[model samples]
Target: MLWGALPYMVIVFCITATIWRYVTNPFSWTSKSSEMLEKRLLRWGSLLFHIGIFAVICGHIAGLLVPIEFYHWIGLSDEAYHMGAVFGGLPAGIIAFAGLVILLVRRYTARRVRATSSVGDWLALAMLIIVIVTGILATSANAVNHSGFDYRTTINPWLRGLLVFQPDPALMQTVPMNFKVHILLTFVLYCVFPFTRLVHMLSMPLGYLRRSYVLYRRRDGAIYPNQNQEQQKERAM
Candidate 1:
């Protein structure tokens, strides 16, 4: 019964929070990069995390959104599909988790970044890591089993039903614990997102193609030479 209500509840909660966030603080919809404080680790970590996450999202779209019949229709067997997911999911999860670790380390080690960090940042990162770890646990467990947990049979229908405004809690109730935990955490993330920097995901700059380039210039009256002695050697003599 709990599972039955959770889907609709989370959907409503996310929708309401999103609406409120957009209305109250539209200007705060940013990821708030700390590139100026530290760029080297940030560059690699951000790249890996984004790439892995994009792949993971794509994988979920293929698995959850696409029905089993579609695969069979395209001459793909269930076993083949499961094998593909096992191979694809493991590396993606690892990459994403590794990147998150790097980002977290950078946040703690860099003085400027650590000074600006908030509780929201830590909470968001912790939840994200939990979601990824649970996901990988589910995938790796299924890979070792004699038969993979065919989520398309259970979780997929339930999710599709939800998309059409129908809630089928029974479908998710039987899902493996790891996968269920992953799903529940995901919904929880929806609730927390509006209050955190995670909202930046929704506001990604899709208009970049049409936007003009930003120009930045260093302010004058600021000393550029690292050593004042170099510029004032004559005065020293």
Candidate 2:
């Protein structure tokens, strides 16, 4: 009951809080990048972390949302599907872990960033690393240790049940300890996500794709925007 209910409760609270935050303090909905203070590590770390996270999210969606019956229908045996999960999940998890290491290092070493960092920042970073580490361990157990554990039969259905409002905690009871840690931490991350820089995710500027680009042209010694507006007001006066 705790496992099933906790995730939904966290998600609901996060959604409600996120909406309130965005509505009341829209300008604060940002990642608040500190790249200007230190670009060297930031560039590499940000690229790897974001890309790895994208891959991880994709993998999670496929594993959790797609039904196991679908794989059987497609003629993929359980062993084959497990192989695919290990092969795909391991690399992505490792890349994300590496990037997270660099980011954590940068967070502490960069004087300006460190000075400005809050308790929430450190807490978020620590939890993120823990989640990634546990996830890699779970995947590695099957890939390296050859335990042949299949999460499709366990975690996947539990998640689907949660989606339909028929959460069954029993579904997650048999999940490995590492995997349980991963799931708990992930939802905890979701709960904290709105109050942190992750809130920027919701404000993705997708409109930029359809919006017209700025066409810069040589304006000689023409006034800037504010100056141009001031001149217009003067003429009106």
Candidate 3:
């Protein structure tokens, strides 16, 4: 299973990266107002998406880094674990889902936005929706599947094994196929990440914010004064 999954993952990443490298160059894709709007959607969508995504990533990293025993040693009972997992996962899932919905709606509902969107854009959003929805379902199902087996116990060992090229199938088997599909979809998404507009994820923090701040300069070479400055000064007085 690892062998089968690993190669495709690598190939996907390579293909995605190559495509993104070419496409993201401003010179490659020509547009004026359309690009501007895409940038706008990206700004808002990315802020929500990246914060949620980073939280999810941090949760995953925490799962890998902190052993179940550590939590247990610290007095985290099963109930506590369940509560923490539910609270952490649910909000992250909702944020990701909302971000995707906003992006998709912008793509289809806005005339210029829809025209500017490509087939790849649609595919990326569809793939992300699948991954996020499946993940939410998997988390819900897990609550139902709590059979006294401490999932926390297995994560660190599994991650250690992954680092050393020895992923334990037993741990993998413990995860349901639906969950497995969600994991696989995530892998596929990563492989394709560099290729899609999803590539914006990597560039988002810098690109998104930079694009949002439209600057203007005065003829005297000073930055243009904010129109709100006088209002703020009056309010302060």
Candidate 4:
């Protein structure tokens, strides 16, 4: 049931919830930046978290979507591929988890940020921490044990089958316990994604291309003589 039914259910829930949220309250779809309250931690944490997570995502895509045969055809041996995965993925996961921890700490320890945070914000951070920790455990275990448990033969195929609607539960039956936990938690994260600020990840700044240029002025400075007229013109345009 975990391998077969849960994935599809989460996918449907994510898609439906995302659409519903968009239609119901489009203006609420923002990351709600707190840079004004605290800049030091936020700058470092946001930078590391985004960079590491992007790398981790790219690794998952290459590992799961691409076939083993293709790698072998390209003259890459199985041992070499696994080595690269461990060396590359382990660091990326560690970096992302570290960044998330920093961000979580900043959120609670900073007074202004904490006051503004909602339950949904805490839920998102908690879910992310769980998922990243499990992923790190899974990768670290494989790196130390070198158990020859080649996931390309099992988990990769299972996930690809899921994409095509022909998932085989047997493929996941023998997967390592840590890997199973990570996979399940990942889907759980997806289920919570649309309802959290994480939804902002799906947004793009395309509107900036056509939107009017923003006007800025010093808070205590005198207003420009034509500021009102310029504002009126932009609104009319």
Best candidate, TM-score-wise? 4
Residue-by-residue lDDT tens digits, candidate 2, 1-237: 467667878988999999999999988877888988999998888888888888999999989999999989999988878777778878888888788899899999999999989877887788888888888887886567766567888889988998998888898777778788778888888888878887776677889999996644346433543456665677577
Q: Which of the two, 1 or 3, has more TM-score? A: 1
Top of the candidates by lDDT: 4
lDDT of 3 by residue, 28-59 (tens): 33212354656767566666776777777787
Residues 1-237 of candidate 1: C-alpha lDDT, one tens digit per residue: 556777788878888987888898888777888999999889988998999999999999999999989999999988788879988988999999999989999999999999999899988888888889989988888788755478999988888988887878878766888788888888888778778888877765679989997654336422543435663575465
**Ranking of models by TM-score:** 4, 1, 2, 3
Model 2: lowest-lDDT 10 consecutive positions = 217-226
Q: Model 4 — TM-score against the truth?
A: 0.90
Q: For model 4, how does the per-residue alpha-carbon lDDT over 1-237 read when each residue is reduced to its tens digit?
A: 789998999999999999999999999899999999999999988988998899999999999889889999999999889889999998998889888999999999999999999988999999998998898899889889978887888999999999999989999888999999999899989999999999999989899999997655646442544456666677577
Off by over 4 Å in 1: 204-207, 212-237
Better of 1 and 2 by lDDT: 1
Instruction: Provide the clashing-pair count of each candidate structure.
Output: 0, 0, 4, 0
TM of each candidate vs. truth: 0.86, 0.86, 0.71, 0.90
Candidate 4 lDDT (Cα, 0 to 1): 0.90
